[model samples]
Target chain A: MTREGINQLVEEHVPKLVETITTHIETLTAPQRLKEAMLYSINAGGKRIRPLLLIATAGSYGSVTNAAYKLGAAVEMVHTYSLIHDDLPSMDDDDIRRGKLTNHKVYGEAMAILAGDALLTESFSLITDISEQDLAPRDALFLSSRLSEASGALGMVGGQVDDLAAENCSLTLDELESIHRRKTGALLAFAVEAGGLVGTSPKEDLTHLRKFAEEIGVAFQIKDDILDVEGDESAIGKPIGSDVDNKKSTYPSLLSITEAKRKLRNHIEAAENALKSLSVPAPALFSVLSYIELRDR
Target chain B: MTREGINQLVEEHVPKLVETITTHIETLTAPQRLKEAMLYSINAGGKRIRPLLLIATAGSYGSVTNAAYKLGAAVEMVHTYSLIHDDLPSMDDDDIRRGKLTNHKVYGEAMAILAGDALLTESFSLITDISEQDLAPRDALFLSSRLSEASGALGMVGGQVDDLAAENCSLTLDELESIHRRKTGALLAFAVEAGGLVGTSPKEDLTHLRKFAEEIGVAFQIKDDILDVEGDESAIGKPIGSDVDNKKSTYPSLLSITEAKRKLRNHIEAAENALKSLSVPAPALFSVLSYIELRDR
Candidate 1:
């Protein structure tokens, strides 16, 4: 798939995934407050990168339908939950996300918190309920574990912790990489690997796909740092220079733009190379990975 | 087991369960904010009814030191997460839980939200990791589904929503029961059913146990309503008539005190009768169900 093709594919998948998520979430009972909070943040648009990754990864192997759809939706649920809690007044305290009011602002902090909790818990239930034909017990368990690690203290939560701790403080390049690797990279890695696990991607190929995801994960964050410094706030739909305003260090702050761009190119190249090792054609994955560093919004 | 013996057994289990819950929560990432929020609310005291039901149910059939321990701890995690989210500014907005600061007040709303999310997600992972010896795949799945039902919208979340919607409004008795059944009864039912699911309890016996749990669950909430109205404030640890102050209707408010006591006794009898059909000597469950309405505080 070419870059334009990948974008079209992602666009097509985004609404379908959103619809599936909404339908599934509507099944949840009383916590309409929490569900509303989840729906608010989830409907706030992002690139739909995580769900796209899951679907694209599934497509890379064989097909992306039925059970694969549930898995894709589950990953997005996890991603959305993280973003909701992350934007809380006690955390990043952001007022806007994806050009919309933060969950707390719209739903109130309690509902926002409960909604995040509900989404997180509901994601596990979603993954575990894939029709028997889609995946087996052990595989479901494996995918659940991957999702857990990605979202748990060892992964995104850990990264958030490090990020918060590092606020108003300088850090070595390696430390920054370590932080993003767990926070952002871990979930991205899970997105790719969960696809592999569900699709029964070969062991060696899984390893390669994971490496590809890891590189792009860090590169994606670096690009985010660059965009935060130089991109249009109206286009990005979030405050530019907020990180700098908060005195938080970023790739652009630590490395010159030229150096950061060079590093991003290196990672993107590495991601492309990793795709070559996949047992099946992965043009879509490669295309998406390439755009991560170059997209303006 | 007599009623006194059941109380003594529960008394013995409380510290161990609290310790386990504390230890498990402490393992949450060292993000001081998140950990502080989790620890603050979790350390607060409660009845530990869910854990007790789980352990007692498990003990009724066989030894489940390892299997029941984790399930007990996991249930507490879910319960605690619900409480933390419930007390958020957007919800009940309570300052104190069990005589200490609530999670949001202590850790800020953001961290409290994230911490609750973490605990909720981690609960499933904790349950799924139960050794295969203790719970087969089918049983594990069953337990997961049960827990999900108990905690999800049809259960706790549903009740919470009704409670929120009815805040400062008069509630009919049927509406009150509907809320309490989902809010408190669902988990209690799960507590007993989960215990039986993990044990060698007959299918029929499990059904009866669920009935028993449901009765006691409603009865338990009624007792709480009564206590909130007439019990000593210091003994209850919550201000007397706060529910009335909030304009939330309770059984004591909806029914005359004498009529409310009659309702409570009726539920207690129903709970005991469910167990009467069970041939197995589930002494602990029997005593607990039998004496549910008579307990003070």
Candidate 2:
């Protein structure tokens, strides 16, 4: 896939992803403050990367138009729910997210929290609904388990727990990697692997797809840490120096920029390596994976 | 089934529910605080009505043990999660639950919120695990759908939204009924219905069991309201009039005690009617439904 092809995929799917999510959010019980809060954080977009990954990965092998769209939408719902809960007054307590007042800040804390809970449950419901189509039952179940495992305690929540515990304390690189692996990496892996899990992708191809996603996942987090230190607030849409302020350990904090860049290179290679054995022509997925490691924002 | 039978059923399942929840809680990632808050709320002794409903309903028609236990434990997790979130600083802002400090009060607002999110996700994960079991794929899918619908916006969350919106206002009896139906009725209905969904119960049996649960669910809420005004706090674990202090609407608030009692009787009768035509003996379920309508604490 050419650079233009990747851009086109993003442009097309980003809008559709937003539309799907918007419709799903509308289906939720309304006039409640928390539901609104959840929508606020979600609609206040951040590139819709996870959904894009699902679509892009699926597109690499087949016409993932149907499964990709729903899976993409489902992942964003989960992501948005996590952010709302994480930003609650009792959690990370962020007053602003994406250049605006956080969900709890605007909608009040209770709704923000419940909105998160509702979104999480809605994710499973949405995925299961996809199976109502021609997709096989095993595909739906596999996809559901992959997403759940990635988002549940063994993955993202596990990472969040570690992240919280490690606050104000120094950590070895391995500890930080372990946290990032579960927190940031697991979902990305799911985003790609889920595409394979749902699609008719062969076992070998699916294995490679997972490897590609795993490497890029780590590199993406490293880039995020780097961007936080130097990126513009207007461009990033969040206050700079939050990691520093929180005394949180991060890639940039633990490694020199040169070393971080080297590590990013290694992960990018690992990501690209997963594509080596693929039977499907996946220029778009390849471009996205490469950009994930090197992109500035 | 007699009084001894109900007690025996509770004894058989409650210990297992407690053990399963505790074991899962112990496996939580770093930040012991979050896990502690979750465990505190989950293990706090209630009558274990929801799980018992699942088990008893499953057992009524045929033998139920393995899958029944899983569904029973899963519903309690969902119920526990709701309680944790309901007590958050932004929600009810309660300081106590089940005669102990609420999740938020013990672990701070943020951890309590995450704990709830975790439990909700875990519930779905628990259901999904059934896909690997002996049940047919479609049956597993049906079980997942039932669980989500009962707890999602159209059900438990919907009721919660109404409850939040009705605060500080004088709600009509009908309006209050709508709130309780979703907030309280949906899960209770699902609790019994999911048992049938996961078990060998036939379609007609499932329908009758759900009808029975729906009536008892509303009656359960009415009894709760009455107990709040008149029952012993020592047994109830919270102070009498907490509802009044919160300015919450209830059956007794909208109707005189005599009228409320009459409505409770009507619901209990409806519940019995739903079960009277069942092919299988469900004496324990009947007794429990009767107790729900009459219990003071």
Candidate 3:
């Protein structure tokens, strides 16, 4: 598929993915305020990159199943919940996210916490609810287990803890990479691998997909750092140089901007190589890689 | 089995349950601090009532399986996560829990939040980790789905949201019951029902166990209210009259003390009737009911 074709595919499916996510949340028999708080964040705009990656990878192997869409929604919900909690007064203490008031700002801290909790819990339930016809119980169990491993202490949460600890102190490049690998890479890897599993892709293809995701994950973060240093403030949503202002280390801080760009290119090339190793063409995944390399926000 | 025999059974199994729970947490390759925060809360003294209830129910039907122990651990982890979040400064703001500093007080708010998040995510993972030989994938999926329903937006979290909103306002008895039923009753019901499922008990018996759990759950909360009004501060591990001070509605406040006691007795009787309806003798469940009725703390 051409880049334009992949872009069109993303545009068409993003809305459907959002609908899938919202329908799940809407069908919940929870309190009105809680649902409102949850939907408020869900409706908040995002690029739906993670879900798209999952679907695209699944598409690379075969048809993207309905279970893939549900899994996509599940991953997005986990991402949103992490953001909600990270924006709390005691955490990042951010007032705005996605150009709107953060969850705690709108719902109050207590409600925001519960909203995050509910989202995290429901993500697993969402997985289990997928029909056996769409995805077998054994596969569902594998997906659920992998999701938790990617999001829990051994993955995103652990990385977040380390990131917080690293603030106000410089970290070695290896340490920095270690944090980002778990913090951001783990879930992205899960998204790609899950798509493979859902599509029943060969084990070797799944391994290559994981490597592709890992490279892109780091490349994506490095690109964000580079953009923070050079991109337009308006294009990025949040203010630029906030990392510098906060005295935190980033790719540009530890390495020169030119060197960080070089590293980013290296990762992108590595990702492309992983895609090349796949038995099937992955034009959508390649498109995603290009987008990550060039995206401003 | 006699009440004394049931008590002996509980005494022997509680330590084994703790060991199983601790082993799971210990095996996680998360950050040291994250693991410490999680273990600290897990080791903090509680009656381990939820896991015990699950195990006892399973035993009532047949010999308990290793999967039952793991499931019990998963439920306890969810319970522990809830308590950790509940004790946060922005939530209940309690500085202490189980006579020790709250997780936030010790680990700080950010780590406390992450720890809770890890616990919640891992609880589902734990279910998936259960061997298929011990518990079939279908049954594991069912348990995971039920757990999330009991603990997510529709259940414990929803009830908590309502409970927080009800503070400083009068609530009807029905409203009060509704809140407790979700906030506390849902997970309790899950523990009993899950035991039956794991033990491969008859579907009819599972229904009775759920009814038994539902009755005891409300009775448990009502008894908590009564204890708050009359029990020793050191024994309960907190000062009495906190609900009154917080202006939160409770059974003793909504109804007179005499009326509340009567209601508690009625629920206990209903719980006993539920156990009696089960095909298998449930002396262990009866012992638990008796404990709930008479315990000071």
Q: Compare the candidates by lDDT and give the number of the best one.
A: 3
Using TM-score as the measure, the top candidate is 3
Indicate the docking level reached by candidate 2: medium
In candidate 2, which residue pairs clash? A1-A283, A34-A111, A90-B110, A91-B110
Write candidate 3's Cα lDDT for A1-297 as tens digits: 345755776786788898888899899988999999998998888767889899988888888888989999999999899889988888778887777889999999999999999999999988998999999999999999999999999899999899889889999999999999888889888999888989888877877888898899899889988988998877766778888877778999999999999999999999999999999987888888888887778
lDDT of 1 by residue, A43-136 (tens): 8888877777777887788777666778888888888888888887878889997788898888777667667766776777787677767777
Q: RMSD of each candidate?
A: 2.3, 2.0, 1.4
The alpha-carbon lDDT assigned to residue B114 of candidate 3 equals 92
Mind giving the per-residue lDDT tens digits that candidate 2 earns over A29-91?
544554566677778877677887888778777776666787888888888888887776556
Model 1 segments more than 4 A misplaced: A31-36, B1-3, B26-33
Q: Report lDDT per candidate.
A: 0.79, 0.77, 0.89
lDDT of each residue in B118-153, candidate 2, tens digit only = 788777767667635656666666677677777877
List candidate 3 segments past 4 Å from native. A1-6, B1-7
Residue B52 displacement (Å), model 2:
0.7
Model 3 clashing residue pairs (backbone): none
TM-score of the A chain in candidate 1: the value is: 0.96
lDDT of 3 by residue, B174-211 (tens): 99999999999999889998888887888777678878
CA lDDT, candidate 2, residue A27: 69
Order the candidates by lDDT, highest first: 3, 1, 2
